[model samples]
Every structure is written in structure tokens, then in C-alpha cells.
Target: MIKSVNCTSFKIERLQTDNGAEFKNTFLSTFLEGCGNIHETSIPYEHHQNGNIEWMDCSISEISQTMLIASCLPKELWPYAFCHAAWIFNRTMHGNDTIAPYEVIAKNKPSLLLLCVFGSKGYLYDHLFQKDLSEKAIFGYHLGEAPHSKGWLFWIPDRKKVLKGASVKFDKNCFIQRIPASTSSLSLIQASSIFDGSMILAIEKQDKLVSSVNVSHDPIHVTPINYREALASAEANEWNIAIEEELTSIN
Candidate 1:
């Protein structure tokens, strides 16, 4: 969970969880204590205390399940569908918010250029295992976005494995019929329309559960944005020495 937000500048000061046995364990308690963080639990039998998270969980489940039903994919591929659902959830606007959660964290709007219909048929370049005379590209099903990458994940039925590929072409109009299912009842809009603008307030309330962890005596280091700032910073002497060394090496 910590790794999920490592890309951002947010510092986690507290953790809130339900009174599950997994969260009440000694190791987790000790870990939080070591990090000088607080751990709080929701009151027993009060589901409203966790309304935002509960609602989000339900939305993700519905979206993923809907994708599975539409794609006619097996239940075993639900993990990939969940990943795709989360990717979409982050990119999409929630409630009445003008900006997405991803925009808040990433400081920019997400690009939808690479997004395609779930279970869309595509061909992935097989540079790694391609024989001299074999086909360079192989057929596959669109899975989801690759973690920490700009590529997409593809499920090659022939190889029976999921492969990450950068260069690929998707046929948005074509969907694999590995398993046929009725997609009449499934709709992505249902997930987005379930909650109103009030849910944003509930999510903001949940944000109070986390805070910045900083000590008074700890010195904060701010990176210099430009050469002038670097010369005027507290480490100006070190910067000057480095600059002189670089000039000397160039000479």
C-alpha cells in the first residue's frame, strides 16, 4: 500500500482500518510504532465510518465485473479487469469534481490516447521469442496498463501468458469470443453515477485520517530550481566548488 503512493510527495502519518484481525496483529502495530505513525480503527458495526472507501470498493468491483461480462472473459482474468477498472477510475471524473484524483496526484490530466475497449483484439510484436522465419507479431487480448510503464499488458492465448509490449495495434471493433456472455445488463456509467457530489465530502473527511509526519528539529532540504537559486542556497559553497570542478575538468 505504501509503494502505491511512493511516486507522490505525500507523507503518510496515520493509518485507519477496520477492526480486522489482520490489522490488529503485533507485527503491523510494531511497524507503525517504529515509523512514528498513528493507527486508528473504525467503530464496530458502523459501516458509514468508511463510506468513501466502501463506495469506491463497490464501484471498482462493479466496473471490473461488468468488463468481465462484456468481454466474455473467464473469472480468472478478473485481476486484470480490476487493474483496468482502477486505471479508468483514476482517469475519470468522480462526482462533481472538475479534476480527477490522478490529476491531483500527478499534477496533470491523464492521456486517453492509448485506451481501448476491454478485451479488444490486438497484435503484439514478439521481438524476444520470434524465430527467423516466424511471424513477428502475435494475436492477443488487451489486458490493462503496465505498471510504471507507458505500455499495455496483453494476454496471448496461444502462449498462455501475459506479456508487456510497447508496439501494438488494437482492433477496437473486434472482441475475443473465448467465452460468450450476455453484456446487456453491464454499463460503465452505472459505476460513475452511483454516488453524488456528497461522496466527495466523505472522501475529503477520510483524507483527515492521513497527515504529514515531520519533526521540528529535522532540517528540510529544498532542491534549487535554477542556477541562481543554487548559488543563493545554504549549500552555495558546495555548489560553487562543484561548478569550479566542472569548469576545471572542461578546461
Candidate 2:
């Protein structure tokens, strides 16, 4: 974290932490000494001394709650929702002005075009684990934007992990909306058809570049899409990048 801070325009001065052994270890002390930073330890059991972090935690927790209820996604995904909320908050306006926190921190204007709806389902290519294009990419739910990336974060259920990549194929036609599984068996059939992208061509007026799949309900929130549809939406270059990430991962 300090290394990242140093890479930015700001020079290290002081860092404060609660009484945690990880922050007080010999290796950490040596590193802090090398960086010429002053380390301040907060009083034991006095969390109020860290009001800034406490407030930040509370704020993120509230945001997480709102998103979980609004999206009807599982509560286990609170961490992902919190991360997404913070990403949106950092890039978008905070005060009565257009300037954002990201701009202030990075000294550059943050682009809004990269933003996606929170808890929305999106697909990512599976070039790495999958042997060939015959299978195409994997599907996932949008967690938030990838840090230091034009890409987005997604929860990969099979691995039980979150992955960030530029290859996220987002299609609005996808079902992040409410669809109770017990309502109808036809809904399940409909879900399968949507995953196969049969409904996209039949329903929508215009041809979407990609037709997002309907495996939408998960603890992690995911939607898969067809590969052919992805090729058109992702464009050649971005698609290539996705393929490359897979290849690299496999190698």
C-alpha cells in the first residue's frame, strides 16, 4: 500500500494504525524505516480514535445493504457490493461539483463511460482455463470496476473468487431484475433460452452486439453469454486481450 502511495504524486509522511501485530512486525518496521515514514499507533481498544476509518466502514456497509436489497442478490455478496459502491463513489461526483475524488487522488479526470450498473450480470471470456474458442468465455456478475483498469470486477463462482478484467461483456437485456425461481417452470426454460440468446433476437427491436445469458441468480450473481455475440460487442482488440489473459493464466 505504501509502495503504491509512493508511486503516486504524494510523498510518504505518517501512517496510523490500530494495535495490530501485522503493522508492528520487524519486517514492517524495517520497511517503514527505509521509507522514512512516521508510524503512529492508536490507543488500545479505542476505535473512536480511528473515526475516519470507522465512518468509512459504516458508509460502505450502508451502501452494501442498499444494493443487496435493491438487487435481490444474496447477502454473502456484501463485500462485492461495497467494493462496487466505493468504485462508483470515487469516480463520480461527491459534492455539488463534477470533480471527483479519483481526479484529486490521481491528478487525472476519471472516465464515466466505463461504469456499469451495480449487481448486473456480465460475461467474461474463458480463454485461459478453456482449451479453445469452442467453449468461449466464462460468465459472471459485475461486482465493480477493476482497480487500475478500464475493465470490471466479477465473481467467478466455480473458483469462489473475484476476477477483474477488461473483457467484461455487459448486455442490458440480461436479467438482473427480479425473477423468482418458484414462480414458474417456464421461467426456468425462459432463463435457459436467454442464456442461449434465443430470446434476444426474438424480443429486442435492434440486434444487440451480445446477448447476455440468464444464469442470473447466484450467491455471487452471474450471467453467461454466447461467444458469437461477444465477438461483435467486445470488438477485435479487446476480445484479443481477453483471449490473452486466458492464455497467460493457462501458461
- Model 1 over residues 4-38: C-alpha lDDT tens digits? 45878777898887654345545567889987889
Candidate 2 matches the true fold with a TM-score of: 0.56
Tens digit per residue, CA lDDT, model 2, 34-95: 98988887764366788777666666667777887776654556556777788766777754
List ranges where model 2 is wrong by over 4 Å.
Answer: 92-98, 125-139, 156-168, 178-251
Backbone clash count for every predicted candidate, in the order shown: 0, 3
lDDT against the true structure, each candidate:
0.70, 0.62
Residue 251 of model 1: what lDDT? 41
Q: Which pairs of residues collide in model 2?
A: 125-137, 126-137, 128-246
lDDT for position 60 in model 1: 87
Q: TM-scores, in order shown? A: 0.67, 0.56
